[model samples]
Target: MNHPIAQRVPGRRPAAARRPGRRPAPRPAARRLAPLALLCALASLATGCGIRATSVPVDAGAAPSRVGCVLPEDRERPDGDGADSIVRLYLVCGSRVSPVEREVRMPDGRSATERLPVARELLEELQRQPGAMEDTAGFETAVPNDLKVSGSRDGDPDEALRLNRSLDALPPFALAQLVCTLADTAAADADEGVVLGGPADDEAAGPLRRYECDTALRTHPEAAETAGTDV
Candidate 1:
């Protein structure tokens, strides 16, 4: 017996037959764009930040350090070891002035401690180069070697010391060193700081200016010239 063929529906097409191993039809535009939208969103997020994307690590230099400004125990002499002969000189350390002790012969056999000799000795010590221990402890001298000190001129105060150079000629740090060193020593009058003047020339003598080594001066020696007091 012969089988009858199926009749075609009017206004409707027959569905295409799918072959084995064949890919299905492409999805709708909306569905196909979902993956692309996700990728675009990820790319936008990566670029949204102001910083640039980098895989390589950057090298920053070592961290900064501060000077301790301290001396070793052996470097500091004991008080029992002839404390009278010990002289304290202010040295520059970490942009400020600090004291360093030194021992010197105090003019043997002299019954009286004169201001001129003691002042000269201390000034010379201030100009001298720092020792190895001092160097390691960040101590340095700012006083110029050629700077000289002499007795006061006529009509000047008995306690005044005249320098070969004028106050303005000296660097701030150097002046601070001298002022602090002298003011802290016996060369200075009791509670009067130190009186200093320039050499007397044919034109005229430079006026005397008194300097004090206060806590502010020790903290900021760069402004030393402004710390002078009226004679």
Candidate 2:
């Protein structure tokens, strides 16, 4: 389901969970941090995933190339100090199931936090999965062995998709599709758990909505020329 964060970047929480927005200003860390920095830089592009319109034709005029932004609402918990804990999951390009990990520290040494990573190839599979539809219940799996989703002292949805080592042998989209299937099933299960545990004991589907802002896709000369033309 599309949430507020889908508009901005991947692997991120929603915006309200982030520091207030600043003009697309240049921040100090904007540069020098190549490699992984590309994503982080892009993350600063917009507060949330901007907007999405219906998928008309592949020729859908005016549609932006990217959809979904990671929201900042859920961030790595600050250096403990009595703050809520934070956990991050990364989808690497082409590694095994074991993703790199990290800890952001907790106020009380009693608890522990963990970050997960995955391969980029895996994430690409997440993008390609046909589940882009409204309510698909099935799932897909890629490299299930090399990856690990071990829980923390207190579990916080610690899951990441990344690539580092292991299977240089890529699976057909079938593999990625499998991972998608499992994740989806897990998400639905989580939703059910939330409702069951909610104070009101009420079950509510998460809010989902969309908007269209970019005119470039539809405004492009080729798209314009095709508009109102015979299918």
Q: For this target, which candidate reaches the highest TM-score against the unseen true structure? A: 1
lDDT to native, each model: 0.80, 0.29
What tens-digit string does per-residue lDDT give for candidate 1 at 150-228? 8887887778888888887888999999888887565687774888888755235457888888989999998887888
Clashes of each: 0, 56
Off by over 4 Å in 2: 1-62, 72-85, 92-166, 170-231
Candidate 1 lDDT trough over 10 residues, lowest sum:
104-113
Please report, as a residue range, the 10-residue window in candidate 2 with the lowest summed lDDT: 192-201
lDDT of 2 by residue, 83-121 (tens): 533422222222212111123332333111212222232
Q: After superposition, how far is residue 23 of candidate 2 from its true place, in Å?
A: 61
Find the candidate with the highest lDDT and give its number. Answer: 1
